[model samples]
Target: MISVLFAVLTAISNGSASVLQRRAASTVPDAEAMHLSLIRHLLRKKVWLAGIGLVVVAAVCQAVALATGPIAVVQPIFVIELPATLLIASCAFRVRLSRSAWRGVASVTCGLALGMAAAAPGGGSESVPGYRWIPALIVTGVFEAALIIWSRRLRGNARAALLGLAAACGYALTAALMKDAVSRLDNGGGVLALVSAWQLYGMAVAGVGALFLLQNALQAGSLVASQPMLTLGDALISITYGVTLFGESLRSGWWLLPELIGVALIAAGCVELARSPLMTGAKPPPPRVR
Candidate 1:
């Protein structure tokens, strides 16, 4: 039950964060400028600052959720927020959602629901171990560095989506490492020891970098496209790590039949949603108080 609560909180935070980020992105004029300059300008703006603050809160909530639940459980719930975000963005900011976008949202939601239902029932009780995070941190750092270099040569929405995807990957890796660290802790001493280690700081840096790239993605494209892609990508990565690396369990072989059907339904929904015309040409709407 606690895990369920955490998942719900994660969903709410994630949904709200996307909306806020999208609102911030809509404020920047579509023009050519250095990415750094754009970030500075957007951050300095009052609207952007408020939007970022929301994202920060969402991040904190996500951390709390990670501390409480298995990544497989929490991450899937969080991904469902992509559709929730679209609905909120449309209603709050008057952004129109094309039929396809709505279908996509429905599809993602259904898939996630099935996935969550099929997840193993045990709550995680183990704390993360120290020293296990070093390799993961190194891998995430390398990936981020590559993204930074590659991002320089790209432009427009494509660039933004790529950046967002990179950011999501970083976040997914960080989540995996953080889960490992938390699951291995024996006491306050262990937690404190891990906190004092350089790896902890490295994780923090990766998280910040993810946010930076995600914001850049929002700046370059419609939220409808960038948000769903990033969320789905992140969820997929986290689920993969959770199951393959962390030994988190899915339902037993007996349930595989229903699970397959659920997955098929979800895939179909995603296709229908992605094909919606509203997402392809939609512009970010102006920010408004909700």
Candidate 2:
């Protein structure tokens, strides 16, 4: 129950963080190069500073949740951020999602709920060996770097998707490192031991990289394009990390079928939402002149 509470709190903070960051990003000069100067400029804004605070608080909540529960359980809960963001955006921007888009939102909400309930992942090792993380880090770093480069070669939604994917991978790696750090706390490591651990440094670096990618993804295109990969992709990757790296296991055999169906529903909903004009604040096309 404590883990569940923390997961919900993480979702709320993360959802609010994204909305605040978007608000801040809109006020600043648009950046395409993903430059450090962009961070400097945003730091000067009170709005962006507030967003950063939420992000920090979110990170704390995420760490606590991961420490207390399986990554599969914790990360999937982050999906709630999408619906929460949409609700907040609607109130703040006075924008309304079309009825069809609302259906899409419903599908996303339902799929996440059902999928998580079915998977019910369990049985994870308290700690991962340092050597195991070496291969994982190298692979994740190379994959994310490649995606970022690919994103740079594109424009518009394509770029946003790629950058979001990169950010998603970085975030997953950060979670894995975070889980490792938190797991060690029970072994008499305490806060000081976590501070001294390599996983802490890895998590910090990965988090910074994820933030850079997220800023770039926002600049590249609409939230509709990036949000799915960011939210859903992170869940998928975190599940992978939990199973392979942390010795966690999900209900297998026939249980896999529902999980796949749930993923399909999520993907379908994301596609519908992405194509909605509400995502970009663009007016719908006019009726034909006949």
Candidate 3:
């Protein structure tokens, strides 16, 4: 129950964070790149700062949740952010919600709910030792860097999608490492004393890098394109890590059928949502009066 509560809080935080970042990114004109590089310079405004703050808070919540909950239980719950962001967009940003957008949100919500219910509770034990996480973090960082460079060669929507996917992978691996670190801290005494010095630094670096790339991806393309891509991809990667590395389990044979259906619904909804005109054609309204 505590795990479920943490998951829901994390999802809401993440969902709002994405919406805020997207709202900030939308303020920059797409034509600014073609018109003048200096015009693009104005993109470095306070909006991004606010968005970054929200994201940082979300990451902190997520780290705490991972520390306390089983991976399988927590990972699927994060998917709720997709629908939650839509709600934020409607209420906070005054973005018009189209029929297709609402449908997509519903599909994703239902799917994620089903997935979460299908997942079983676990002991949240340390599967991988604290020291082992250092090497894993380094390897994941290198891979994420390679993916970012590779994404640069692609163009338009393809590039944005690839970058979002890469960011998701980076985030998933970071979550896994954080979980290991948190478990290690539970061991007490000198172990926590020794690990605290460098582990926190490493986590901060990884978390910031992932957030930056995710923001870049959102800035580069439509929120519809980037959000669902990142959300769904991140969910899949997290689930993979949960099952393979953390030893999370499905409830029973009956659960597998719904789990498959849920994933399918999520994927289909994300695809539809990503291609929606509301997202692809979204533009900032005129600046409000003070």
Worst 10 residues of 2 by lDDT: 278-287
What stretches of model 3 exceed 4 Å from their correct place?
26-43, 92-96, 119-124, 130-146, 190-197, 251-256, 272-290
Off by over 4 Å in 2: 26-32, 88-98, 271-290
Is 1 or 3 the stronger prediction by TM-score? Answer: 3
**Candidate lDDT (C-alpha), each:** 0.65, 0.80, 0.68
Each candidate structure's TM-score, on Cα atoms with residue i matched to residue i, is: 0.75, 0.88, 0.78
**Candidate 1, superposed: residue stretches over 4 Å from native:** 26-34, 87-102, 118-125, 128-131, 146-148, 180-186, 190-194, 197-199, 251-290
- What lDDT score goes with residue 199 in model 3? 53
Best by TM-score: 2
On the 0 to 100 scale, the lDDT of residue 204 in model 2 is: 94
RMSD of each: 5.2, 3.6, 5.4
